[model samples]
Target: MTETVLAEVLAELAELDDPKARAVNERHGDDHGVNLGKLRAVAKRLKTQQDLAVQLWQTDDTAARLLALLVCRPRAYDRGDLDLMLRQARAPKVHDWLVNYVVKKSPHAEELRRAWFADPDPVVASAGWALTTERVAKKAAGLDLVGLLDVIEAGMATAPDRLQWAMNHCLAQIGIEHPEHRTRAIAIGERLGVLRDYPTQPGCTSPFAPIWITEMVARQGAAVGRANASPGR
Candidate 1:
């Protein structure tokens, strides 16, 4: 029964593939060609199927794993299982979705964050930083903002592209959300000059840390102002 279900899902994914989509995804380091909307539609139809999700993930097909992530219970996997799956997920989209959709909700997220943040693999380390960024924004109770900035300043320039992007994002989050660290974060970004020249589509915010921080802070301030101005408190 499982084999048949897996085969049917594979057939569905194969049918969704498009050469044009593959070409576009290739530029972003994702090998799968299935339209994300179509894949999600399939996942919606499948709903929660941890068994089927595991089977799909085991196939090591990018599209299949994406669908698996969409349908699986995020808390079902143990720490080791999530770690192994993350290591196997080399494609950018798969890695991003797994971290954002599954690991973020997992009970083992902080444990994995501690382990993966220091992992030698740049890609895995990037996931660690990604988790740390979430903490920086939401649950920054004891995190050393200065220490994080220190690491980002020292290594981000030379880190691999993906890891550097993660660190850069953390920096921007700190500056955007914490008034005390905003000046130092902007300074680090200005001095490093990483992603300063990154190409951004028209009307999209630049990923360059200083600009991102400023734009987000401005938007936040605007939001606060609007709330304060709202009638009848």
Candidate 2:
């Protein structure tokens, strides 16, 4: 089944220059065109197939490689194929690809979460941001909230001003996602220190607000925690 999917993808890749193919590709390429129309067609045909994913994984073009990464769902992941994609995904856009798809979709949440912590690229770092935002909010029992927190800790420990700014943005995102656990974020603010904390910098786009601003988060979470601690209310 995988091989058959691969064959079809290869066939498409081979005929990329054919007028019929060009027309189809053009239709897909136009930003003004509806993506659903194209996506539906692709999905229906590729529902059970997996080869189109493989060819794109193997493609030499950085854009094509990133596109393939974006197209494949996290659930469809073949570890070997993902390993290859990560290895070949040297371009910045590829990291962005992982950020938007794997992190945001987060189908295989845990493995991809680990990747965000380990990957050094800014784009991959953004995945860490997404995970922090998505998981910390729910406070899922099995998800490694502590491990994700460690990424922020490491970022604060080593970050220079520029990198610190970006890392802080990620921390802020975590806070927004988990307003229920603002105390967990206090460490992030404390570690980040006085430099442009997110709380004080009202206009700043960075998500990592100063710990003080987390007052709202703290208040909300505290109320919930207190309520939960109480008997039946």
Error of 2 at 19 (Å): 25
lDDT against the true structure, each candidate: 0.96, 0.54
lDDT of 2 by residue, 5-101 (tens): 5566545544443455445535434211213344345545555333455565676654335446545666677545454555555554455455556
User: How many residue pairs clash in each candidate at the backbone level?
Assistant: 0, 8
Model 2 spans > 4 angstroms off: 1-50, 103-107, 115-132, 142-151, 157-170, 179-187, 190-204, 211-233
Q: Give the clashing residue pairs of candidate 2, or none.
A: 5-51, 6-51, 172-207, 172-208, 198-209, 198-210, 199-209, 199-210
Steric clash count of candidate 1: 0
Model 2 TM-score (2 dp) = 0.49
